[model samples]
Target chain A: MIELNDYLILSGLLFTIGLVGVLRRKNLLMLFFATEVMLNAANIAFAATSHYYNDLSGQMFAFFIIAVAASEVAVGLGLLIVLYKRHGTLDLDNLASMKG
Target chain B: MYEQIAFYLFSVLIIGLFLVTVLTKNVLYSMTSLAAGMVLIAGIFFTLGADFLGVVQLIVYVGAIMALYAFAMMFFDVTKDVKENNTNGSLIFLLGGLTALMFVIIMSAPIMSENIQALYPPMAGVTNPQAVGMVLFTKYLVPFEVAAVMLLVAMIAGIILAGKKMDQSLTTEDDVIVEIDILEEDEK
Candidate 1:
């Protein structure tokens, strides 16, 4: 079994990769995937820490996070669909038209 | 020894698929990779002794939400979105450096160094899945109900909004095409 500290390190690395993806990727869908990566990284950390602490609350919180992620994807993708129909594309550069 | 080997294997799959999720130009493929990443994360949760969460993650994430994403992709007719891919440049390197600095700071945290043995002590033998279900259904019944309601609302909204696109795409294609042909004939 891997140590909890090692798990934390893994979580941290995953989150950073996710952050990089979110920052660098211009495609909204890719960014959404990146966000999922970050959320899962946090979820892993939460569950691991809870395991280390012997508390049920962490796992419970992770459940809540999972619920929220599900809801977000549902709504967010719905919006993305609308955006695609309007803009004809998903590039962030083109998304600027909505700003001004 | 077995644990280490398993950890390495899973880690390779986790990180490799994660990069694939980020790098793949195809949105559908990206979503698939994301689903795979979620499943592997659930496995991580299992290894961490969070059995309830691990199963929930798999069910909710890989099963439900990934399907939802795929369906939305189909509904949207995302033919244009795939064409305008942006190449990520220095952002990855910069974010890597920043996160490294963060890791250094996090690793050096006094609280971490203080050794919270009081935290998760190893209960390597017990199965607590039933215990969590009991708590979720009994103690947290109200919140659970509310969450179910929230999920219903979100689900309904997603259906309604996505439904609009299908309706629009068909109607606009039919109506607009007829209107354009008539306008062109009238002009001539």
Candidate 2:
């Protein structure tokens, strides 16, 4: 049987992969994608823990997370579109004009 | 036995697809792989017996959000190459790996000990959806409404941001035309 520990470990691995992606990637879109992956990792942990504890609260929390993620992606992608249109490139390094 | 196999399979698929999502240079490819990874995560939710959550995951993540990502990918001129210039790549990887290892060890420590136990036993008779709805509609009603409001605000904000970009582009085009006209008069 798959135990709670197994699920938690899996979530941790996924979250780590996302962290690596965020640190390594230079594309703004890919950064957003990595953030989404990290969010999903959190969701998986919440759902798994809820299952383990037989509490619906965790599931409810996951549901809220899903809602939040949806809104975040929508707004983020909108901003990304605006940024790309203005800058004509999505590379993170080139977007350092605001650096002081 | 079957659950274990399914869990491993889904996890592997998710992790692999996520790697593809982040590693690939093509925006469309990355979005597609991310969508696939999301579907696999929904599968994991199903394997964990959270049927409502699994379906919601499929619909919200794989269906709705990914469609938005695909649309955004198309909005950009993705012909230019995307490159990662991580100068201290080895150092970053080493640090990231160590951090992940530490996180895994800390998170799993409690579960490894025999003393850890669930506070409540799994509900036997109630269906997953019913149980979720019961709490969501009653105890979590305020948060639920707040989430709805948040979605509405996001929708309005997305529309405004995209629309503003369109206006800015149009104005910039006009400015470019006026600049060209002034240059032509100067030459004359």
Candidate 3:
């Protein structure tokens, strides 16, 4: 039988990988992808726990999370398009126009 | 035995695809990998008996969001090769590892100490989708309505932002004159 710890551990590892990607990647799009990975990691944790505890609230949270993620990507990609138009590049190094 | 094997397989596939999505320099490849990873996550949901969530994940993430990503990718002249210059790589790894270790320790602490009993054991005959729907509409009615509104607002915002003229330098007077000229030309 698969234990709850096993699922939690998997989630932790996935979240770690996403954090590394977020820290190391320079492209905004890649950052968003990493963020999605992290969100999925959380969703897995929630679902696993909900299953272990025999609760439906966790799945509901995951459902809402998916909805929020969809809206976020829509707005974020729109912003990315506008940013690329203004800056001509998506490289983080060149997008430091607001540097203090 | 089969459940354990399937769990491991889905986990491995998801992690590998996510790594490709994050580490690859090619944006299109990354998007493809992301979509694959999401589908694999839905597989994991199915293994865990969250059938409704698994199908919803397939529809929302792998279907709708990824389609939008593919459409957006076409608008940008993304470079085929992207060079990454990570200066503080070691420092970042050190901090990230420490944080992850902390998170794992904190999260697992409760499970390690306490014997948590499941309040609602998985009902073999109960339909997962119907149960989820019952709670969603009854207990979460307000939040559901709010989510619908939020999606609507996001749709409007995305269209407005992406459809705006790229040349922001054009004055309002110039824009009005150009619109007027186009209207007059249309009438002629």
Best by TM-score: 3
Off-target runs (Cα >4 Å) in candidate 1 are: A98-100, B76-88, B96-126, B138-142, B165-188
**For each candidate, what is the lDDT?**
0.76, 0.86, 0.88
Fnat, model 3, is 0.71
The per-residue C-alpha lDDT of model 1 at residue B71 equals: 76
lDDT of 2 by residue, B21-134 (tens): 877888778888999999989888888778999999999998999888878878787766677777887776777778878877886676567555554344579888887787
Report the C-alpha lDDT of model 1 over B1-188, residue by residue, as the tens digit.
77677667777899889988876677777787788888888877777767778888888888998887777677555554365544556766686659756864775485467665543333455577866776677667887788788889888878887678365577778999999999999999
Q: Give the count of colliding residue pairs in each prediction.
A: 5, 0, 0
Model 3 scores a C-alpha lDDT of 0.88
lDDT of 3 by residue, A1-100 (tens): 8988789988988898889888889988888888999899999998998887888888998999999999999999999999988987778898887889
Cα lDDT of candidate 2 equals 0.86
State model 1's lDDT. 0.76
lDDT by residue for model 1 (A1-85), tens: 6777777777777887788788778878888889999888888777877777776666776887888888888888888888888
User: Which order, best to worst by lDDT?
Assistant: 3, 2, 1
